[model samples]
Target: MAELLRNYVAGKWIAGNGEGTLLTDPVTGEALARVSSDGLDLRAAFDYTRTSGGAALRGFTYAARAAQLSEVAKLLQAQRDDYYAISLANSGTTKNDSAVDIDGGIFTLSYYAKLGATLGDVHALRDGTPANLSRDQSFTSQHVLTPTRGLALFINAFNFPSWGLWEKAAPALLSGVPVIVKPATATAWLAQRMVADVVNAGILPAGALSVICGSSAGLLDQIETFDVVSFTGSAKTAAKLRAHPAFVARGARLNVEADSLNSAVLAADAEPGTAAFDLFIKEVVREMTVKSGQKCTAIRRAFVPKDHLGAAADALVARLSAVSVGNPRNESVRMGSLVSREQYDAVRAGIASLREEARLAFDGSQVRLVDADPAVAACIAPHLFVIDDASHAVRVHDVEVFGPVATLCGYEVATGNSRLEEAQAVELARRGQGSLVASVYSNDDTRLARIALELADTHGRVHAISPSVAQSHTGHGNVMPMSLHGGPGRAGGGEELGGLRALNFYHRRAAIQGPAASIDALTESTGKVEI
Candidate 1:
């Protein structure tokens, strides 16, 4: 029997009371650990954070809170190798994939730390300068962002456990909001372990951060109007969370980063052998194989010029063919298994759904494993579906396989008469409802600019790449702290990162109109001691 992973309640690490649920190793199909959060005092946990955690964090200035984050980042980075080893067993991700999550989390912490430190010591962030409202300038109106008087509930998905938790926590904590993290049950061990490390380091204040590793029963019921909830998962789950009575009726804050059917396009003017075309193929292949295409930002569809579809397909086949799939523990393996057998089955179901409107461009059932047995390992080869008549392929747009899978759609270029105009490409991209990102590969300055603008409303981020800038481009799926990373409709209309803007999720903005002395007293702008 695997040892039970304990949940951190209040300030203590306590073993779950229920017969724990088993967590399996993806590559070997063996039990790795057991997780549970039964027989826990749900109300007490929330209250502990609300009182102890929130109070302690509220005591610090923004810069002091950020400085604490820097300490946590340094502690985690020193032990990153341990996280890498653990991820190899549970996630079946290579060192590179683990670094993207583990290292990326540290980087995010540091980024937010620096951002907050630069703001100096302040209890509240003042928005712009106070405006003069009175004719004599005695009265003015000012806007300020202040931390919510409650805790933050972060419910993250199975993939990128460490990164998901840290990315949300960094901002929430900096905003002086305590956090209660509920990681997806399957990969909660990593999150639990990371929290345990932070606790052991004695960096964060008591009850400032907690992780519960089991069902979220009664969890949503505990949230109130002042609390903020940030979720990362499927669209369906995002909707359910958004509809929670506490959020829907009480008006609690909710920021959801759901999986989107993001797309990448090849410039209509690019020839088959051009650098732009080659970069497109490389980007797709990388997204497909990395973490076995489990990233929320992974490309789910590729748009190519009709005349160049065959060439693009051929190039993709060559690149994907060379990818070696096996246990992530093997140095030779390039791609590895899905997180677990359950996730493997889910991806299989998604693939079956895709077959209704598209043919298999790259067969996945048949593949060679480098250092593992295909019969027992929870692994699937990269899959490519070709949309023969994209105009009517509703399933291709509506369905997302959420694994190493994508649909290829063709849009004809101008040859005296352009079969598919840039407007049509934008229309095809919008069929996804909304997405986290959409990338355009084009050399035509006019066409790319129009496509980018048209896509701006539909996607959280728009990435444009050509041979001229492709060399320096950050690739199609990369998310930066300086940019907004959420979109509308199906992708969940929430925003994150974006520098100081991210702090908005954990803050309340209010406008005050009053005399200058009163305004100065409320915001402490007159230097009568900061709030």
Candidate 2:
């Protein structure tokens, strides 16, 4: 029997009342651990966090909370090697992939720590300059931002267990809000260990940070109106959460990041052997292979000039063919298995759905493994499809195959009319309804700018890659803490991680209308104010 993973609740680590779900190694199909939250008193957990945790966090200034975050980052850094080992065994991620989640989590915490230090010793933030409310200027209205009097409940996805937990926790903690994380059960070991380490270190207040490793049953029922919920998962699940009574009836705050069919386009101006064309091909391959295309921002659609569609497909195939897939422990393997057999089967089914609408350009289903058995290993090779005409292929735009799969679509380019080509590309990209990001590759400054502007409304981010910034530009799928990471419409109309902008989600805004001196005193005082 595998060890049962304990849930950290109400300031103590406790085991569930029932036999838990078993977690396994994807590459070897070996049982690693078990997780369960059965029979835990969630009502008491919520009360403790709201009172003891919320009060402890709100008692500190932004700088003090920032110091705590810095300490947490240091602690994680010291144990990063352990985290890497766990990621390899359980998540089946290579060193590079592990870094994206483990190291990325620490980096985000450190970034927010430094950002919080600059906020000085204030517990409240002024929204803007005070406005005079009376003719004599004796009275004024000052908008203020303060932490909500409740905790933040995070329901993270399975793809990024470590990073997803910390990314949301960093902001909420810095904003003086408590956090209770419910990581996806498929890969919850890393998250549970990280929380246990932090709690045991006593770096954070008791109940300030908690984790429930198994079922999310009755978790939403514990939420009150003042509490906020942030989720990252499928759109179908997000819809169910939105309709929950906590949000629908009581008006609880909810932030969702759902399915996004991000795109990458090679502009008409970037002809066959140019730097822009080469860069486009390189980026698409990187996005598709990284984390086995499990990232929400991965490029699902690749658009190219109609004349160069075959050339683009050939370049992608040649590059993808060189990638080795197997167990992460194998040094020669470049790609690893999915998180589980369930995910592997889901990806294969998704590939079949895409094949119905597009022709298979490169079949990776038959690739040889590096150091793993085909029967048990959940490894999959990269697959590339080409859609001759995207206008009628409904699945090409609608379906998001969350795996190492990408479809190549062509946009017609009219002779001597670059605007028409740009417009058509935008139209094709917009078919996603909304997306996390869209990368437009073009050396032409005007064309890049025009397309980027047109794509801004439909995408949370527009990554315009030119020759000048080719070396400096980060990959399209990489979500940086300094930029926005959510999308609108079908992609979940939520926002996150725009520097200090993320703090707004955990804060409550109010306008204080009073005498000028009183307003000034309220804004300038470092003392805590009642929420």
Best lDDT among the predictions, by candidate number: 2
Candidate 1: deviation at residue 257, Å? Answer: 1.8
Q: Give lDDT: candidate 1, residue 50.
A: 94
lDDT (10s digit) by residue, model 2, range 1-531: 999999999998999977799999999999999999998999999999999999999999999999999999999999999999999988999999999999999999999999889888988888877899999999999888889999999999999999999999999999999999999998999999999999999999888999999999999999999999999999999999999999999888999999999999888889889999999999999999999889999999999988999899999999999999998898888988889889999999999999898998889878898888888988899999999878788998999989999999998875674555667778999999999999999979788998899899999999999888888997898888989889998889999888898998999999899999998898566433222
> Which residues of candidate 2, in runs, are more than 4 Å off?
414-420, 526-531
Name every residue pair that clashes in candidate 2: none
State the displacement of the C-alpha of residue 203, model 1, in Å, after optimal TM-score superposition.
0.6
Q: What residue pairs are clashing in model 1?
A: none
Total backbone collisions for each predicted model? 0, 0
Predicted structure 1: lDDT? 0.85
Q: What's the distance in Å from true for residue 289, model 2? A: 0.4
Tens-digit per-residue lDDT, 196-310, candidate 1? 9999999999999999998888898999889988888888888888788988899988998886999897877767777777878889888888889998899998888777878
Instruction: Name the TM-score of candidate 2.
Output: 0.98
TM-scores, in order shown?
Answer: 0.96, 0.98
